[model samples]
Target chain A: MTSAPALVPRPLARARPLVEPALREAVDRLHPWLARIVGYSFGWCAADGSPSATPGGKGIRCALALLAAEAAGGAARDAVPAAVAVELVHGFSLVHDDIMDGDELRRSRPTVWKAYGTGPAVLAGDAMLTVAMATAARTGSRAALGELVGALDWLVRGQAEDLAFESRAFTGPDAVTVEEYLAMASGKTGALLGCAAAMGAALAGARGEAVTAYRDFGRHLGVAFQAIDDVLSVFGDPHRTGKPAGGDLTSGKKTLPVLEALAASTPASSRLARLLLERPLAEGQLTEAALLIDRAGGRRRTEAWAHIHHQRALHALHSAAPLPCPKADLTEVAAHLLHRTA
Target chain B: MTSAPALVPRPLARARPLVEPALREAVDRLHPWLARIVGYSFGWCAADGSPSATPGGKGIRCALALLAAEAAGGAARDAVPAAVAVELVHGFSLVHDDIMDGDELRRSRPTVWKAYGTGPAVLAGDAMLTVAMATAARTGSRAALGELVGALDWLVRGQAEDLAFESRAFTGPDAVTVEEYLAMASGKTGALLGCAAAMGAALAGARGEAVTAYRDFGRHLGVAFQAIDDVLSVFGDPHRTGKPAGGDLTSGKKTLPVLEALAASTPASSRLARLLLERPLAEGQLTEAALLIDRAGGRRRTEAWAHIHHQRALHALHSAAPLPCPKADLTEVAAHLLHRTA
Candidate 1:
């Protein structure tokens, strides 16, 4: 048997532009009828429900799934359903999350609940969840189906934990610490990504060792992705990010930066904690909170933390056995995710 | 190869008192740990969370599940998990339903949300749902797990439909027809009961025709049970039923009686339709609605419908292939469910 190849760096100029087209093509090939509904909900269509042909995100999850499969010497086509399933599940989670978070906009457009009523929006989310599970059960291997189900269980558990956290009277500074955040995100974000990669590996009929390696690679990449997201939530350009500056802080969402800031603050941190506890922050208070976060060196710390995870992700990919051409594409995808502005 | 036993005409008096103890013992046996949490939330326990030993209602779902398994020749011990699972799911649905319906009391005690905050109550319901699924997965066979999952899917679908119905601006008098109501209740109620029976049969290792027979018996019993519940909701004693008289009519729940009444009435049905449309009736409107239902002979017609389904359940039990002691116990269980007042 051929050993996996060492991770090779592709020339960034040539590799970067190909990702979007490939993702668009992959999504285009999903079941045409179901795609109509899913595509519309994902904002690939207009209010009148006309197809817009505008592609969504870079398809990071699908790329990881296919890459892991191909790295295991499986055909990428065999992993398509798993890829679609992951994306659909992701979309389903986003729809519900938006409602729970009371966010009015996503991807610079009105959210499902904002555009449609909550009732229909909820139904749409449920439909997506059902369709994802159905696709997995129908097209995926029994083992892959089992893995996907476990991943979903993790996702639900993560959501429950996050919601529970939000409702608490006071969460300790350590409660939202980096390690705890990572654990929560592991279930919230990493589980599905790892499942995607592992599922793809399973589809390729990969043996034990290679599948484990691919899953590890995917998990590291998922952490790296979320770390980058936390950074963007605080520091990215509002125009590029398509979100207001310091949206996470304003919303009282405890992202990596805020958590780090609270952990590292001097005696002054207690005052900040008191302010947050007193009542919902005013607009001016949000700006001050951002300033405190910056003064506490949170931005630098979070960035350094993100960079470490990024390096770890690359290390994981390198350690895995050499993948074929399609599998190698995943490394490029990982880089894109880590560096993505929006 | 022995056929399932025929139902003997045992005296109702002999079996009536044994029903409560057997149900209590079974519930006590099934959920040793989780049941305490559920029991407290379900008002089977006091506010301090101690078991009140206050008697529960009919335990219809558990009895049906156990009976189905037995009639299919499964060991009762092996089927206990399925029985517990169905009961928990039913209880979970009822807790959420009561919240949605704004009902203040259940079993002559405060509802979960009335006692606990909505947030905790929602979590309690979710926890129960989680426990039910986990129990099914852990305790049942692969086929039984699949059946349970399918039943859950149906339950969610039924809830979606029910929620959808509540928000409708106009369900044509034609829209609230008997067939539609049956379909709704089948998903809302019958699916879990069918799953319970099917799971029990699966655990018993019943296959082919016996499994189908048990499933049909459970489904018919569920319909009969719901029909009786509808009758109770409108016409039963408030003290014993633990609900207001004309509860379904007042809530505009569109039960079988209301549907039958609306469908069978002459042009005067429009007057009753208007009463329904003007829901949350004023001071004397509840009494007037009850009189209107009586004028339309809805009570008697709905009773006849319940009797028909009750007979169908018995017919199904009789036609099932013979088992030994368990099957006889199931027949007694069926009779007790059909004739139960509270």
Candidate 2:
């Protein structure tokens, strides 16, 4: 066993049809070629524009939005546009990130950039983003539009910072501090998820404080989710890749664990760094690197951080809506994220 | 002189201060790091972020917006936000285009991509686009938001097509048709300019027909502007770089001349294709390529097309607002573009 169960809460999984039609509609809004490329990127179509049955990400963001609206005592259906807008933005970012990160495959298929070539991928990403704005506008909420724009700005900033972390520091160190990594992660992932949750609350006509609470909850949840995912990439069950592990360690990503081990000020810290610095990480090296990270307390500390964020998210959600309890379902979501058995 | 005067018209020049402040404010809205890069892209800052006296491109898009407002019988001042939004979007596209094209210099200074690196440049472009949307939203018109989004969609589509033309088929045997080139030009340069002009009219509460007329006028003007710029780059006086006129020929851009020459059924067309097929055009080959292109009627036909669009723009403008005449100032603007001489 490597990590947590791959499960979304029942209600979140069931909420798909409520959000997906609108996603398809947003894709349809584009011109034919643009629509075809974007639809393929979203796993809605195969390489030749045929309908695809590929299961996409659990769409946790959409579920968060609908749940937020439901928790606010509003009809979740009314927030469909907001949900669709969130998905479009997410898709846009994924397409661009796949290109920028040189990711060749996604969701068991070739990435948009891999299949359509870089130029078309770029154009498709831009189109998705444009449609996202138009879709958001169609919701007829200027304030929500402003909120999403602000989140997107943070997203870009975070991406810039993330790329910068790849470079050596001006003082000659290439190591990323834990603090800097957290800030970057918050911007890159937390900001957009927080925006999604807040958008849902806003659509439900929740007051400012309630919306902010949802935003904060989503922000914490986003961090928690990323932390668990990073842990899984290092030690989780080999996601059907048929290999024991070839994830973050081989790529030299400075995830939470790596950063923690680097900051340990111990012999294992140097050992972990040495392993990480090797390209074409030798056979058995990824497993070795994981062991070193564990020895340096990187794995446990990261899990504890995830637990802390999960708790914070729950607390914030409680403040967002006290009357109706989503404690059980939301807990289920968190459990799926954190209960790893690696 | 082979073309129009090398000048900005009086009206366009006078509209500078009215538009400049808004541009500065838009820059100020960015995070400090982002602001510095974007401002440098706009030639408002030196490499070290200090203010620079470097002159930027003539604010033709801004002037069009103001002029469109004035033509629609509205005070130009009332359209400041619209103008600012246009400039922001324009800057966003320029930054991205520079990165994609690997352009190292603009306005006699290093491009953002060249100065700040690709990742930062991409982030700045994204930030500028977000700001453009927010700035457009400040105009308080959902209709204009829709208009801008529509134009942005076209912009992406055109860019995709333009990039596609760089392939062998489009530039070689399959040879991009004149119509295809026109459509690409319309999207690449015309859509945003047309959007800017129509945005100005729409901001002024112009009727639907009036706004549409302004949009058509701007689209025609954008195409005409691109056509003349293509011609100038091939034959007009060389820029301050002191390089002889080998700009487009050496790059093998599928410009009006190249496309026209390719479409021609003659020995010279074959000769032009052979020359273009060279891996790196020889030092003396660019001049020969230019002559072959001209002999194939590329230059004359392209100029005629520009003139036709120019007439259409004037016709559309006249239809947009008949009550108040902007005949002289608008003519000067047109002349400056169409009659450019070095």
Candidate 3:
């Protein structure tokens, strides 16, 4: 759990050149050729229910997976299936989570349920989950299946807890802190990413401590990614992030920035908290809440936290560097993830 | 597939006499000892969440699972885990299906969603599903896992189709026939049972034709059981069935009896269909609809169909009987299932 150094050699930075093409090819190959309904919903095709050439997301999970495998001294080909599976599951979770959270926007477009309706979205997510398990099963290794299932279990458990939290009214503004929020995020977001990395390593035949190191690296990196995301939710540029600033604030989400602001706020900031939580925020209130978090130094605090975890992730990668694998690719992948803006 | 004959002794039925007690004991042992807030919505526990001696239903799925193993010439001990897994998955499906179908009463008691909230009910069902998969995984062998996953895939697919059928405003009064309904039922119910038998056989080293026979027996029996239940839904005495007369009619559910009635009915049956489909049926309309189905000979036809499946199942049992297992217990189980009043 120790943090990595703030600076390291950039030998793996060249991974950026290969990451996108490799990821797109892997995902395209894994895409279901038969079920058009599912294939369309996956955003590989157009919303008009026709096949299209649009690629989805940044493919961060797949990158991490491939890198982890290579870091474990295995070929990227060996890890491609696991990488694809992770991406599918991650997308599935996002689609379903959007439905549950009532968010209408994803990838700067209408959410799955918004476009296809709730039932289809649910079914699509279920299909994705099934495909993920099916993919793992087809890989035919008990240990690999075990890793996948374990990751999924944690992911679902985290989601269940988050949903439970959202459904209830929190009594006080500062009922939970940034640390507690991190725990939730660890499960909700970090676990899957960690699993993606660990599973890649596992598929590559990395056993014992190397597997643990890869998993820990992903876990720490996931936390950092989420922490950065929380910061972006409040302070990032809308054009770059593809989301309106203070979107989470308007939705009354108790993300790290909001939680940190609540803890650090004075009585004046209480007014902002009340405005955010008393009811749905108006457009003007969203701006006010974002400003309040800024004034309270919540944005800076979250950024600092993200940086710490990012460093720790890289450090874990370094520790795992000596485990007899090609360390360059994984090291580059970890750095790219830490530095990602979206 | 041709239906099997009626007089051949089923191995599941014959083995049941010896395995029933042991199966019950195994279930008892497997039941969580914590006395926690489990099985509350299942109505197998009281408000305080304490286990009730007479809480669970007839446990038909459990019996079939054990019988399948025994019929496959596997010892009950080896098959008990598979049996338990099948039953758990069955229960999980029931809980979720009730929620999706908006069913309030199951087995004459409030459904999980009605007893608890939707969240708890969903969670409970999910927990059961997780347990089922985990149990299957623990049972070991690639074949067992494959069978379990295949059954699960069919089960979920059947449910997705059922939900799709129900979500539409007009599911066509006679759009689907008895055969289609039976196919749905087979996927929704029979697949797991077949898997149970197959898994048991696999565990027992019942290879090739013996395994196929056991699976066939279980599948036919499952279809027969459902057909009988459908008949009971319409024509059987409410008190004996432990459900309201014409419950399916009231729900506008496309059961075999109603489908058969609609298919055979002339202009006279149109009124019944309208009554069932226009809106939720009133108590008076329910009675009128039931009488109309009787007048249309739907009741007799459905009963005859059930009898045919029952005979088929019996024949399948006979075909599976040469696998070197006790005949008495399997025969008893088959009789108990085919002849059950509720």
If you score just chain A, what TM-score does every candidate get? 0.83, 0.92, 0.86
Candidate 3: CAPRI quality band: incorrect
Error of 2 at B35 (Å): 3.1
lDDT of 2 by residue, B74-191 (tens): 8788778878888888888888777665666666677887898765776687778888887887676876777788788788878877777767453544777899889998998899
What is each candidate's fraction of native interface contacts (fnat)? Answer: 0.01, 0.42, 0.04
DockQ of each: 0.12, 0.46, 0.18
In the predicted model 2, the residue pairs found to clash are A2-A236, A2-A237, B3-B340, B4-B339, B4-B340, B4-B341, B5-B339
Better of 2 and 3 by lDDT: 2
**Residue range B223-283, candidate 1, lDDT tens digits:** 7777778877876788878877777676677777777777766453556778877888874
Winner by lDDT between candidate 3 and candidate 1: 3
Give the per-residue lDDT of model 2 (tens digit) for A6-107. 655586786678998888887886767889998898778897899988777667778777777777777678667777878888888888777666667676
> Number of backbone collisions per candidate, in order?
8, 7, 16
Q: For each candidate, give its TM-score against the true structure.
A: 0.79, 0.89, 0.82
Instruction: Score residue A15 of candidate 1 by CA lDDT.
Output: 28
| TM-score of model number 1, chain B | 0.84
Candidate 3 or 1, higher TM-score? 3
